[model samples]
Target: KTTTAALIEITTTTATTTKTTTTTTITTTTTTTTATTTTTTTTTTTTTTSTSTTKAPIFNVNMLNNGDAETGPCETDSNVMNPPGWTCNGEITQLAYNNTFIYSRVNTIPGTAPGGCLFYGQISGYTSMWQTIDLTNYADPSLIDTGTVEFNLSAWLGGFINQNDRAGVSVTFLNQANQTTGSVTNIGPVTDTDRGSVTSFLFRQATGFVPVGARSATVLVYIIRAAGNVNDGYVDNVNIFMYQ
Candidate 1:
């Protein structure tokens, strides 16, 4: 009986229980960039100019080295005419038979001792004579550019013994068209003497003459015999220049 009661109490007891839960977290990052630009420039410049040229004179008459003779109707003898290489183009007889020539002459006339040759013509009938030479072909006005003309004259009135025989010389400018541009008179009448056979006269005068629409110009020489009664006068050493 005691053994049966102990087995029944041992069959008596056992018990068990379970539960689960979850959670999560996150992080982020960012980046930025920038750019710049530049520019350049340049410049330039230029210039210009002009020029000109000149030429020389063509004709020059130096009455030096007497080599001319006289030819005209004024004197009773052939001695009244201009020398060779010259011409008798003025009045046949006026104011004691005036004679003239170009380049050279004998410079003789009785009572007119030391006669001055007429390089240019004379104004017919007038007490004084006026003559002109053609300088058209010689001067190139266009090529002249610029310059000055000059000359020298020495006259002896009466055989260098007296100053009674009066005379004068002048300079004139001419154009290609054979026209007068300007003139300078009374440059000389300087009395000469046998002892002082020649008096010096200088002409550095400016022509200040221009040719109208012409490509050339000329220098004219005029000799005037004023006194009707006197010994012959003489002219020597004529020259000219282009100043430019």
Candidate 2:
């Protein structure tokens, strides 16, 4: 029994042991962003200038060609009434006085006229000087339609010291049918009354208006020698003006 009790105590003396272990975990995070940009540019420029356009109408006017008779017929001057741009309704002869050729009363003697080289016109018989002004396209028809336009006609006429010759000037406004739209007449600027009264000269002026629907103006400058060639008259510096 004693042996048996000793073996039981030895068996009870057997022991048991226990052990524990721990583990740790770690984490890391990161973020990134990218951007792009662009730009543009522009440019500009400017300039300026000046001009002239305010002159009066009187200084700048001419409806017909060669109205001044400066060119053609002669190198210097002539008495032939058949000038360019003008129709010779009749014939005239070139008459010279004191060595000055009769173109329009160019004085042969110095200090006689405004200029020594004056022109003398010898109109014989029933000869006439005629021209046409084309108002159909160039004129301000609106002004004429309202009877507000005026045509001014003028001329320098003279007598050869005791000449019985007389001349007359007239203007006729015509329609497209060639009919009279308006007219102005100074029939006998004759020897005693209008012309040849002075050694200098006479200036006669007539004014008229363009009738509505008129397209043209026909100018007639004529001379009448009452009896013989002694009726020969002179004319010079014919002018026509149009305005208000």
Candidate 3:
């Protein structure tokens, strides 16, 4: 009967949770932080250099034509003494150095000429010859006008033994009109005393600055016979050169 009394008994249930908060604190703080960096590069360059040079002009050539007296017909007689490049006055003869009529000995001339012949004044009186050179063909007009050009005039002059007979060479600078512009430059008249009274040639030269406004030149060769049937005044190796 007690059991049947009634099952009206109520049961109370309590649920307790011991949260083992392992606090894994995995704090998955997914803090997504991203850093960006930029880099720059620099470069250098090199270069090669070069140099240039210029050459100067040469001015050592002789400007006078037939300066050696080897061109054209040459003869031993005064009547046939017509040199190609010159104008003659008195008997201007081209004779071989070994002419038996005048030189008794072979090659009377101490020095040898290019053509074995040399200029000789064959007359008893004064004999003269000349040649005109056009500077326009050999040098710049400005150089002459500015007085910057220089000249070298040279010749071999000789005379007979103990005689006053002598040979000479000279230059006369002229303007375009052929008028004289400067004093004469001479290099000869080799006196008997200068040649030691011997029959031999002597080298003579004259150098000077060209006169201003000079455009042409006249080369004069002369012989003065003092005492001999044959002038015996010899000339050879005439030369003229221009330089800066």
Candidate 4:
């Protein structure tokens, strides 16, 4: 953030005047033939002035991955799991191998089976899976900066039958007092790939319907598997930035 100041000026002016007179003593001695006259004038003036100016404050916050333990998530339960102004809900586990976090939604939604909306990983030639996490813990509509909420996200989806499966992130706005202000969702599907690797996804707050009196907000990223077969996705490098 940055700030600057300016100067102003003012000016004024004024004027004034005076008067005088003459007597008739000679007219008294000369009786009938004498006369007298008198006259006066005056002027006054003044001036005044003043000056003033104004300035603004700057604020910024960056949630990015830079390999720093304090700024990146490398393992489950890592000290950097949830930084300031953020929280996690549900069964979200951070993986140490690639510094990625996985959320499972299995069994949480009705009709969903063993790994309904969850992520599964290889376990000794077998497989391990868990349920999805709720975004409410990460985003509070009331805390979002109504003017600047942008998400620079990326993920990877390994070979699976559900290639058309949808997955994405969501953001909620909150007021300065930390109350729910509004909510919006960003949805998309992962592109099918033979080998798993990082893929990019970007989500920003919509132009219209921004929250009122909101100073900040929360963002939640999810790898959704739109109802279908048991398809799992890998996610990484989720970046959050706020404009000044």
Candidate 5:
């Protein structure tokens, strides 16, 4: 059976009522049914979603921009700005297909995030990258209960062997005026791989949640070198997953 009707979309006002009606026909039968109007009292909610095929299992959407830093190639020193979602202070690092930087996730990881590249901090210095997301639309400034969001921010960090070489990501909560909301350093200070006082190429993950009453948030990725910058660490797969 085929049913035909003009499509009508309506967004009802709060403390309002919505009613819908339907008519069915089989040429031999006719039936008309009217749906009872639904009265909705005061209610408020905000939902934001971004699509992706490869995502962490916990969330149905990902809000990070070019979250894996593979939006394009991080070639040559002059073109470090290739990672689309962030303003970076570090170098863009890439993986050559000559058989290296390979792991289980690199083979099985999903989406637009390519597995062969990362961000790298310079040796003998500090490197930082940042991105911000506005949550003001999702929050009610006067109500703390309505102004909160929960999410996990993550980044994959690695570097050539050494004890002082370290990389980590931090998330800071901000108020609507771009002011700090008394929350910073969601997760951080992740160190590098070391063996008998010598640092080697290795990577790991660091992640944490954003605090409540945050009208916005800023994410930062940083690398620190205890010694020289040779074989300095690399970062990739930076991501954030909102609570479902």
Candidate 6:
């Protein structure tokens, strides 16, 4: 009967379990770095200059002072003989020619002679007067050194009637040491024969190149007595000129 008693029906059920796995992935990161450089430049500059000077050459000028003999204490018979521009030796005087004793003695002064006065030799024998002109005053040293200067020496030289007494002029170029640099240049000692035995003057002139190294020039007026007690060497309008 009932002994079936509760053989209870034990129903054993087996369940299958499904497992889900969560995987965490860690990724390693690697980084690479680089560097760069820059450069600069500069520049500079400069300048310079120079200067010089030059002089002009001289032309057409008379280098002698008082060449006309007009500045004088003019007299026929003067004791203190002083012609304004010359250093004199022996007896020398200035004679008034326009209306004085000299005009009567000379008979005629040249028309070219300046009307004021004349140079006279008052004593017998050798008589001389001179003047030194500084050439640098008229021309540049380069002009004189290179012989670019031309000289014109001129005078009216004369003597008394039929006498051997005579007058002459000369120019001597000198160095800085006062030594002669070249041959002397002379104008005239117009003789009584050349003057036709008349008491009058005759014109004379000379032209030439200036000597080298000539810093100064000396003008000499001289007289020689041949037949008279008084020196009859007469000169008028003596001149020295320079030109390029």
Number of the top-ranking candidate, with lDDT as the measure: 6
Model 3, 154-217: lDDT tens digits are 9898888888789999999999888999899999899999989888889999999889999889
TM-score of 1: 0.38
Which prediction has the highest TM-score against the true structure? Answer: 6
Query: After superposing candidate 2, which stretches have Cα over 4 Å from the reference?
Result: 1-69, 74-81, 93-123, 187-190, 193-197, 227-231
Clashes of each: 29, 9, 0, 29, 9, 0
> Candidate 5 — worst ten consecutive residues by lDDT sum?
96-105
Query: Which lDDT tens digits does candidate 5 get at residues 1-244?
Result: 8888878988786875666667776586567788999998977777878863432223424566766756765543323343556787755344322223333223332232345555655442776778886644333333333323356666665554445566777777786567887656644454543323333223333344445556677888777777663425556677766553
Tens digits of lDDT, candidate 6, 102-150: 5677545554554667778877488888999998787777778898688
The per-prediction CA RMSD against the true structure, in angstroms, equals: 12.2, 9.7, 10.2, 32.9, 35.5, 8.3
Query: Which clashing pairs does model 2 show?
Result: 104-119, 104-120, 105-118, 105-119, 105-120, 106-118, 106-119, 106-120, 107-118
In angstroms, the error of model 4 at 44 is 31
User: For candidate 1, lDDT tens digit of each residue in 9-103?
Assistant: 56545544454445555555555555555555555555555554333455445332232123332333323333233323332222122433311
Whole-model lDDT, model 3: 0.79
**True-structure lDDT of candidate 2:** 0.55
Candidate 2 per-residue lDDT over residues 59-133, each given as its tens digit: 225454543344344223334535556677555433334333443333432222232222223434667668888
Per-residue lDDT tens digits of candidate 4, residues 1-244? 5666555555555555555556657544555855665555555555555543222222133333321113334344222232222344432333443222332222122221122122222111222121222222333443333443333322222223334333444555566566776665343334443223222222222233444555544555444443344334433334344432
Best-to-worst order by lDDT is 6, 3, 2, 5, 4, 1
Minimum summed lDDT over a 10-residue window in model 1 is located at 94-103
Per-model CA lDDT versus the true structure: 0.35, 0.55, 0.79, 0.35, 0.55, 0.80
The local distance difference test score of model 5 is: 0.55
Alpha-carbon deviation at 197 in model 3, angstroms: 0.7
Clash list (residue pairs), candidate 6 = none
Regions more than 4 Å wrong, model 5: 1-60, 76-82, 90-114, 136-144, 193-212
Between candidates 2 and 4, the lDDT winner: 2
- Enumerate residue pairs that collide in model 5: 123-229, 124-229, 160-200, 160-201, 161-199, 161-200, 161-201, 162-199, 162-200
